[model samples]
Target: MSRLLLLSGGLDSTAIAAMTRPDQCLTIDYGQVAAQAEARAAKQVATLLGIHWSMITVPAREVGAGLMTGTATDPQGPPDAAPEWWPFRNQLLITLAAAWGVTRGITVVEVGTVASDGARHLDGTSLFLEAIDHVVASQEGHIRVRAPAAKLGAVELLTTSPVTEDVLAWTHSCHRANLPCGACPGCTKRRETLAAVGLLQ
Candidate 1:
């Protein structure tokens, strides 16, 4: 059976893609502040994985009330206590992914979300996954939503996956794609995570 992965060109999703060894990887561009970065990183990662990939464009021009839309919170800002949470991002992404799966005859749709995301993103929680699974099942299409990294942290994710320094170098976790803007909470957290695992310089 073929599997589909929702890759964002970030460390988490990248690792999940590697672990699942999906037949195909999927990504979306909603013209967010990080759109270019995600595109670049996703391309690099797809090349490394040697998997067929495709992209979709979400029709959202103006910034909505989420980080992906570039209106609610500053994409480059550091992740705050709540991290300017993106409202219903995971639900939207997964819902879209499931729809794609239906068309492609794919039985599985995977995400890279982890437990850490639950603090800020509700859709990243296990409960949300269960909900999506139910939604997908209702189609009677046998589609399943998988999150192999749901229980893992960055450190554990890196160790279990075959990701190397070279692979990581191609990752894009910065909310701002043009430059890392390492001061952002996303960058700071990525740096800290990598450093803790002795992967950072």
Candidate 2:
């Protein structure tokens, strides 16, 4: 069965790409501030991994909230919303990927969610995965959603992946800008995860 991976060029997704080497890799630019950097990193990683990569632009900055949108926490966001939380962001990405996949005869859509992701956003939880899987499976395409690394943390995922340090270095996790704003949650997580994996000193 053909598989499509929703690659974000982050630690988790990059590791997943190295491990699975899916049939196709997709990077979406949903108007996030770091879209360019993320796309660049994803393209570079895909090239290095010999995986075909494609990107689509579906601007949604108008509806985006939190750090990724260059805005403060949306007043209407959930009480437990993280600083970089985007409303239904994962759902949107999954739907878009499935839409893109179905036309290409893809049977499975994979995301790069890790265990720690659930702590920051409900969409990263297994429950969310199961729910989204059901929702998407019930649709016309019947494409299945999977997160093979969902049970592992970033460090663990990286360690288990075949990705080398050079390829891993190509990942971009900054949510605020093309160049990393080290203070942002995305950058901080990347830094910490790299260090935990002994890729950084």
Winning candidate number (TM-score): 2
Alpha-carbon lDDT of model 1? 0.78
lDDT of 1 by residue, 1-201 (tens): 778999988888888878878988888886667878887888889889898888888855353344455555553333452444555567777888878778788888989988787776677788988888888778857788889899998778988888777877888887644468786667887898899888777
RMSD (CA, Å), candidate 1 to true, equals 3.0
lDDT of 2 by residue, 1-201 (tens): 999999999888989999998999999999998999999999999999999999999999888888899766353477788889898999999999999999999999999999999999999999999999999999988999999999999889989998899898899999888999898889999999989977788
* Candidate 2 ranges beyond 4 A from true positions: 73-76
TM-score of 1: 0.89
Please provide TM-scores, in order, for all candidate models, with all chains considered together. 0.89, 0.97
**Residue 87 of candidate 2: its Cα lDDT?**
89
Q: Residue 158's C-alpha lDDT in candidate 1?
A: 83
Give per-residue lDDT, candidate 1, residue 32.
Answer: 62
Q: Kindly report which residue stretches of model 1 are placed more than 4 angstroms away from their true locations once superposed.
A: 61-63, 72-81
